[model samples]
Target: MKEDAVDGDPFTTRDVGVAYHAYSASGDVTAPVVYAGSGNPSDYDWLTKQGIDVKGKIVLVRYSVPYSYRGFKALAAEQRGAAGILIYSDPAEDGFKKGRTYPDGPWGPESHIQRGGIGYDFRVPGDPLTPGWASVPGAPRIKAADAASLPKIMSAPLSWRDARPILEALKGPDAPATWQGGLPITYRVGAGPATVHMRVQMDDKVRPIWTVTGRLTGTQSPDQLVIVGNHRDAWVYGGVDPSSGTASLMELARSLGALAKRGTRPKRTIVFASWDAEEFTLTSSTEWGEQHARDLAEHAVAYLNVDSSTSGPDFKASAVPSLNRLVVQSARDILDIEEGTPEMLSNRLGGGSDYTVFLNFLGVPIVDMSFSGPYGVYHSMYDNHRWMQKFGDPGFVRHTAMTRLWGVMALRLANGDVVPLDYRASADRFREFIKEAVQTARLADLPALRPLKAAADRFAIAADRAGLRIETLLAGDPPDPAAAALIDRVLIGTERAFLDSAGIPGRPWYRHLIYAPKATYAPEVLPGVTEALEARDRKQIALQVARLAAALDRAAAILDGSR
Candidate 1:
């Protein structure tokens, strides 16, 4: 609170103030703040069995339990019947030994609070009114009550300054070490022998979502499309989580748009989207893509996601393996980092922010562009303009760099003689998926297990065979147009192969290779079919990989023959 700490920037101080303001405005007061322990689905059931009504009640829960995002399950609890949810981060997990807190250093301070929605479920994401289909204005709307699911309203952070008052009031047995936190008091899971009350009221109103788009139409294959996007929204002054990355995206758009204006249009249409509601689980883009699903699948060459960038020590990318080489080539052109390979930069798919809908449901080959700048101020009041300016990107150099990279990749995809989708890499990745499929099958019921395993084995063989052929084709030379188109179509078919028209167990709208059960903080609501379908889909995926591989091989043969 010192004058010098203000740093002469109004946004920095304002962001800090805004963080406190959000906490004060959203906190609940009337209901007894009972502890739901971990806040999982089973916890909800246990509370019900104990005759404790969570509906119309304010529940206080801790973060860093079995589930990183407690809001997801808690929101589902609210739908089942709970009034308000308050999630506080225990000091034990993210404080002290982890490093210094904000103002002191980077990690969240004692007073810092993490505010987020409990709206996103892993099942699917988009306009609630139109589940599987698009949400066009005149589209028939599903009633809110009839809507598939409800997320509990909750927020969290790594602080005891914000948690002290609530934890002091609760009375219960000593918490297990796993449940214990850094707080001075003996941790206890309580429905309150002390009996604190909590109350919450939200506007529950829909806000206008903005999606700034710029298009570059290709000359040779105008209908074939390639899209790249980044989100602009943040919890507070999200200088790190989104703004940093979004700025890069805007730079890319400017660069690409400038190129088109200069009469250097690509061969396929390229679009850039600055999406809204990404913090709330990709609400804007998912709805837009879902609405335009058919058209998108038909024309979409690929979808690239650029999110959460910073002046990092390193650059990382997680993309559909098929595009591994392409991403690497592009990144090396733009960045100075030595860890140059796309395969090196790329990581696995897990829950956090965007890219869920595109890859999980729609089957769009998604590439998550990430920049890990230090993890000191993540989800804290310190994650403001000041932090970014000081430790992040002061000169906006990285922003400019990423923009250029986006332009290069978009141009490559749009203007290439053939959509450069490499199926050998795809086949190789599918083979890895077979291992995951078997793991999934092992978790299934006995009746479904054998069939699933059989399917997985079949897929494993197909993927291995096809992957080898595709690699051979690529190693040789470029392929004929027809063969290339076949490869492209086969890549496209991989996405559709995993979709079940019947949808996930509950929510039907999301159909893709992976399953994302809707969760609050982790809201990429895509559901893969049951364990039984795992093997079957595994096999189907291999077949699709093979199909693309064969097409690419044929194309290579034809190109060689012609030569």
Candidate 2:
């Protein structure tokens, strides 16, 4: 409840303010600390074997471990009894000398600290009070105490200024070279002579989350929906991460709104969302998606996301395999950036933001876009409008550029009579995956590698033949209904192949291709397949490729008006 608890002005407005007191923390406290390396749940195995207990202790976890998510979950399990949580950046990942520090360069200064949530266990996130539903007006809610997955105590962050004293006092094993940071003191993984008191009692107060949605209904296929979203909140002066993207979202809205006002409505309904609670692991979007899971699967066409936009030079996209080409062409048609082409800039997907819920859980095709190169000042006090003006897109020129790009793509998707998803490009991506899968299986000594390889070659040839036909259709005229439906359904099902009812090793909610699925939704998977554990994933992928080729052939026949 203190004024300083919520650090900056941007956090006050709930949507666009700077100070966010989601959790309680202290910077100046001196506490006896223990280093848990990556703080991973697996690390507990090693710690317990050494007879070291982290319960009733303050934990120091280094950032950028192999699996930070797993590490955080382990720390939270300890927090059911831990005194506090202290997370800091390791010099090896991103610290002084690797690059520049802020004001002087792009790296964080000594005072910079990393802050994040310590609860949820990669299962679900929100006001632990509300799960699987919106925290909207008059909604039923559970008490934080009854919230089984909630963290018992609040977590806070400390600057290296505070980290030095605690670390220096410790007397224990010299930390692995990989764990060493920029501090001159010998990094010892410790439980320490660094004894001091630490305490945190967070008020699990409920805060309102805003989801600003604006719609432009299409004239023809109004039932099909195209949604684009970006978060609008910041931890500090979040001008680059959320605000930069937030500004672009605003520009996109204004541009579309202007066009709609001129009677240029799309052929399909388009919804633009400015989400709250994205920084806290996409709470708002995920909860909303969970509440509407069934309806979204039935009606939604595609969801595109733009986060962390700045004046950075290169643009990158991580897409679900289904929309790979559609996303590529749109970026090419929209953005002016040149670096082996935007298509080449695309890469394998990972988890960080809102798209996880839609693609991972609901099986919706998604495209995530952002431009990242150098911004040393992320998640710190310096991530303000001034830093943005001086170092990022000053005066929002890039906002206009991005708006032009987002606008064109949204327009085409929302207005086109036939969904222009290029199945040929999709098949190409599948072919590439087949090649990689074959290599991986050979390396792993898995059987049937040759059969998979032969099947992939046949699929590739079929794809090439289909590619020529689809290209001719694009060059001549849009495909007919039978063709369009065949292509669209195959596109949807092929992308959905990554979904397994079994989900990931620990988390069942993430059933998507590239990221972790949400916990509340049922896994999307192929029907009638024998549910056998230990079946080769490469086998499943190859099977899906063959099915996709068959669907494409059927689509070509339909589009040619021969069906």
Question: Which candidate leads in lDDT?
Answer: 2
Those runs of model 1 whose alpha carbons end farther than 4 Å from true positions after fitting are 1-9, 15-29, 41-57, 65-67, 76-83, 95-97, 152-159, 328-354, 376-381, 394-397, 437-486, 515-563
Q: Considering every candidate listed, which one attains the maximal TM-score?
A: 1
lDDT of 2 by residue, 226-324 (tens): 889888877666778788888888888888888888988888889888888776657778877877877777667888888777646566777755566
Tens digits of per-residue lDDT, candidate 1, 298-348, equal 778788887777646466777776577778888776774443543455434
Error of 2 at 184 (Å): 2.1
Q: Can you give the TM-score per candidate against the true fold?
A: 0.79, 0.77
For each of the candidates, the C-alpha root-mean-square deviation to the true structure, in angstroms, is: 6.0, 6.1
- Candidate 2 lDDT at 206 equals 74
